[model samples]
Target chain A: MAEKTLSEVNERIRDGSVRVVTAEEMPSIVDELGPAGAVREVDVVTTGTFGAMCSSGLFLNLGHSDPPIKIGRAWLNKVEAYGGVAAVDLFLGATQPSIDRGIEYGGAHVMEDLVSGKAIEVEAEGVGTDCYPQLGLETTLRLEDFNQATMVNPRNAYQRYNAATNSSQRTIHTYMGTLLPRMGNVHYSGAGVLNPISNDPSFQYIGMGVRIFLAGSQGYIIGSGTQHNPQAGFATLMVTGDLKQMDRRFLRAATFTRYGSSLYLGIGVPIPILNERLALSTAVRDRDIEVPVVDYGVPRRDRPSMAKVNYEQLKSGMVRIGRQEVATSSLSSLLMAREVAATLKGSIEKGEFVLTQPVAPLSLAGSARPMKQTKEFPYVEDVMSREVVSVTEDISVAEAAQAIIKSKFDHLPVVNSAGVLCGIITTWDISKAVADGTISQVSQIMTRNVFSTTPDQPIELAARTLDTHSISALPVVDQDGRVIGMLSSNHLSRLFAGRRPR
Target chain B: MKLLLRVAPGIVRKPLIASVILETGALVNIERASIDAVSGEIVLDVSQEKCRQVKDALERLGVDVILLEIPVIRDDSECVHCGACVAICPTGTFHFEDWRVVGEPGRCVQCGACVTACPHRALRLVLK
Candidate 1:
């Protein structure tokens, strides 16, 4: 059987004679007609994936203001956007957290809000210059107000990804979702056989300048993604497209609670059935793709791998690990993937969508390296909570209790008139005072022999002391023994939980 | 029908499940029980007709009864069948059958633990 040429496929698509099928549909078609016959009959195979792509962001020229400020610092709805581009140009990263609300609101939210026709507050600051004299400006702007807006993502469409599970005794929060303790849940991210790059494993027709269905609009592949590693079992691509043509339905802003904000990208790639090889690759199924089941409980990227399981076993919902059969779940949305493929198929059948040849093929070589550790040791002053809420020794028992409750602190540092660390009062002490009806001053019930830490001391020492003494918080004092800040177990846990060993 | 009962610390010594079975004459399958000297919780499957009688009897015994509904498996076509829900479920409501995830609705406690544990957001708890 002769393979179809790219031009022939395009002509067939234009004339509404080409048969279009999705990656999900190709398997049965191949089974029915065999490889050679299927390659001869099918003209295109559409693939897609809807997963969190953190390396995604939008570049927009906010037009020009009345005074025309060269935005050195910019923010959209309190989420900081990169202002280092041109005078009015800004790049809002998908994972950039909201300044006020942290991970809950971010650049992805801003993009979704803009696409939904919601007006967003655009605040920018810059040094006044001769050409652009405005120092600061605050105004609401919509997506329509932008001179040019495009989604320029450094990475999207991962070919495949590992399944994550926790082996440790404690639950871990990750971008992959929450992993319960002792192999509680395994979370995998990828549409497997339906993924675009997975369907085109060798990057045959997928290259720079290839037309793609991006967020419901016609888009193109830009280049290899930031960490493109074809040798590492999967391919990654960098893509770009006009943001104006995109819809709010295809763009969603998601907050992974403690893990932070991410953008759910809907990308569809159409492959021209150019050859028998290409047709066979597109017929790949979940049973054929394999990924490692990695333990996220280990704090490093080189975490222990319990087993390498295929998507069939993963989709089967259970895999054997040693003597136990562990459950699995996927983070990628197969529903969206199928929808994209179906939509692409409909467009091709209607002779509305056309395929594009690559301007340049992606590089097949290159590897990504892990981040190196720093040599510097951090100090207590660097990590301590500077916004100290201390109670004076003269405050009444009721007042002390109220302060502890309002601040949500189990222990409150007691200070004196001379700006010195006097003592520390705890909730237990306040409860004791309330029980005895000794509603006098905090100094009467406060613990005087308080162990304090110094600003210049290593943070590890303070943490060790807190753990060793079973204390909740420690007051950080300066050289003059003046209370400067407070360090708590909660603060330390948050810092160390996600941190790699230096 | 299955129900999860939270026995208060004061009624920890009482045979709440036994009393309910006797009062309702309902056949009970204690799928899982985590009772201690202080307090306890149990997941029990009983006859559908006698479920109400069993619930009332447990309530009279000072036990907080929660009717368990089978968690609807959302979008099974999209399910990869990884058993993350099995690891977190206190009751063996989710298990592997020929490497596929099979939901035992009769044994489900409706704890909602599996719903949150499902990475695909497939399982959802609904009232019976």
Candidate 2:
């Protein structure tokens, strides 16, 4: 048997004699024909993955407006895009939240909408300059209106990732998706054997300038992705392409409630059957790929690990964690992955697509490390919820209840005429009073033994206090015992969730 | 022949399937059924000779009958076994066994909820 080359594969592809199959089909084919036979018969195998890619965004060069302002701020459907570049050029980060709506809408949705040909409201403010007189502009723009619309993602195609599960009593939302509490379900990302990087684990052929199928268009690997960890059993790549050539069908936006917005990217990579080694690599099975199962309940980057499980075990629907069988799910769409691979295969078979040798191969060494702490402690004021809505003790029970209902707050710090902390009233206290039929006065039902947190104190101390008491919220106060802000579990959860890498 | 039927609220209260079987004398192999107070749908396999009679009987009973080709699984090899389909599936078509996600197309009602709920977009409903 002779070794194959990319040029020969391209020649075969052009002549309609190429034997192409998807990554999903390679395993069985290799099993029947053996590695050498399979390599001899097949010319290429296409691999793909469609999942939540947060390190994705668009760089748009908007044509300059008449009397243009040197735009310093820009927004798309209320989601802010960085306008620090030129007056007409801006970069939109996929996870950048909406200023007004927060996580509900963001840059990802704006890009998806643009790809779908929906007009988006573009707002900008600029400092007036002689070259550009206009200081502010608000207008709708579509993908066709841009001078250049390009997707220049810094990192994508994670080689392998940890499967997430929650051990705490409360459900936690992360980029992994909603993790059900107490290990109710495990959520894993990546299409395993169907993933492109998983097939090219060593970055042998996949590197800078390698042709790829990006968002329904032909794109290229631009460089090594951020935090590229080749030795960590997975490969990552930075890819870019002309966004104008792509369609909405291949690009989508999705929101995971509290987890924020992410781009659903359709990517496919075609591997040239260069050798027997490449053929065997492409035939890697799901059972052979292993990823760690991490406990999402832990609030640290180096969170506690439960166990390492292979994709076969993870896909089995249930894995034994200790003595219990825990259910698992995947975030990456296997259906879309298959479709992408099949679509690429069709293109290759028709001689419309050809394999490319990378101009520059990817670096094999480098590892990502967590940010080191510079300060000993973080202040409570930094994390505390400053917008405190309090109630006066003189108010009636009905008034307090109405305040709680209208504000949608679980607890209200009660203040006296002197603006001093008098007591605290919670929905639980109100409910108990109502249940006991003593709902006449607010002071009678409010708990007087209120514990307060100081803004100057360490956040860890405040968190510890909240955990020790098992309280939902703590009123942050000054030395005078006047309520200044509120600290709650929701705030802590957001802080920790934000810390997790996308 | 296999058929998928959508029974309206008006016909849901009646013994429709039993009546159809009695009238046509055709064996009804119900693949799946999701019946609520408002509406109901069922997938069943019957003899080709009795398919036309079953459709006529169902229409007479005010049930919308659709001659359904089996729902095609576009890609089974890529399934990650996340069980998102198991939550919303009215039919016991999707299940988790041995820690992996499995789909029994024989029991599928072509509801399309699993296709929507699957985060990975791994399941697609192609009704021929």
Candidate 3:
């Protein structure tokens, strides 16, 4: 009987066949060719899967797939962009490429700015429970940066929560990753000028990625996950099925894959291939009854630590119900798998490969040419903060008025010798005092022990504070009672009116 | 099916990233064709310099490092006195004694080399 491989199934793929072929010696493809193709042969070898995921870095096995990107061009692009065309506009009055892209992809989607050659990343913080595990990550895919040694970045990254052996009572974290956008690139050293893609200065290249985890055991299989890259959508696929209780060594795997751009027919290194369905089904059925560990490539000793325990024994133990419940729950498993599949399909449709999009266009999409949106937002610093001014009791009204004008504010903090933000003196305060002819040293007319809000209080709350106090300006203070910025009543008006401050 | 625990090897590769940090090693193209045989022995062929990296990784996991080398030799002079084998000896085991990068089977693991290096077709690996 012939053994069935993933590629064999790919041959029978009816629209959704994800190709899993061992493509070593796949021709070194160089997108920006000069002399020697900027890449070499790409090889995909398997090591026994599973790392204990020690400290700092997350580890995993990407059984047999890899991402392709040349390194030299990536390096060159990074260097060239340093003070290139974009730098001039960024310094002068040119609308940057990123500004245009920001408008195109909208604040919700982050594309790469060709001028900068870096993708903007969005942190997925408070989405939901299901969205927590696979926090969204995203970047632009510059296929043109392909290298000769077709780079194969295995889909291997997991957080430190892969519970394995004692996972039932204690979780063995089989997968974990602490960082996102782990990049890989290939630098070709070939001296010959070959393809006419780009100049030779582009010697280095770049590719970006994220982390994921998959697990099975305890009578539950998880092909279910909830995450999607916002711009270039993506989703995880898992398989759960019951195997016949036979007594032979076997293999069972449910593969979820994405078919890449046009694939070459010829295989790598001596080209050998083979597959079959019924034979595979039989092979899967006759496996020994030992439970399989969900491999997420965590480092050794750190992964889900396994202990010797038979499924039959677990069933006998009075943990939950009898052996009947231990078998399987058709409805729950089916519903989870369906939901996961639906998410995957939706992501593919929406291009949410990593779940979130950048607030700007800072990726390799090259759409970052000088334009309106790519320019740094003139109002971001202001929106993220308040403009503040301060004054002192010893200063005369004339001095306070001068301080407000010098600080480019209508108000200044009126502090005493203690430097405490006692009261706020705005242009109006000084003007009124001056007009009433009762104005002396600022202390004589200044308000006392006036209330102030923390810098982080929402604009709406600050507005409410101003309206309640009938004040035109509110002093923004820090925890130590230090005045940081001024939340002018005018600023609140702008916010409430939905005006993006210039 | 009987479950087997295959520890994924930890491969660390350093790049020129502000004093490169240790990362998963370079991924070799693992062919699924290895399953086509009943032979369970793992074959690793890399430069002697790289062999240390692989050896160190496996040894950390407590794997007994059993290496194979040529187990036979004729007259040390019949060594073809040629340097073909020297070019490929990962361990740099071959060196010039008398204008000859001659190799002795005693220093050789079962890895057949002097056998193939003999352009005169005098050498052959005596596989045990």
Cα RMSD, each candidate: 11.2, 11.5, 31.0
iRMSD, all candidates: 5.6, 5.4, 28.3
TM-score of each: 0.71, 0.67, 0.20
Fnat for each predicted structure, in order = 0.19, 0.07, 0.00
lDDT of each: 0.81, 0.81, 0.29
Give a tens-digit lDDT track for model 2, residues A265-358.
8889999878878888899999999998899977656778898899888777678788778877777666677778888999999999899989
Candidate 2 lDDT at A399 equals: 90
Model 3 iRMS (Å) reads 28.3
**Chain A TM-score vs. truth, each candidate:** 0.77, 0.78, 0.24
Residue-wise lDDT of candidate 2 within B1-128, one digit each (tens)? 77888888877889999999999999989877889998988888888899999999999998888886657473543344445566345556776564356677756667675664554446776642
Instruction: Tell me the docking grade of candidate 3.
Output: incorrect
Cα lDDT for residue A305, candidate 2: 82
lDDT of 1 at A223: 85
Specify the highest-DockQ model's number.
1
Give stretches of model 1 more than 4 Å off. Answer: A31-34, A373-502, B1-128
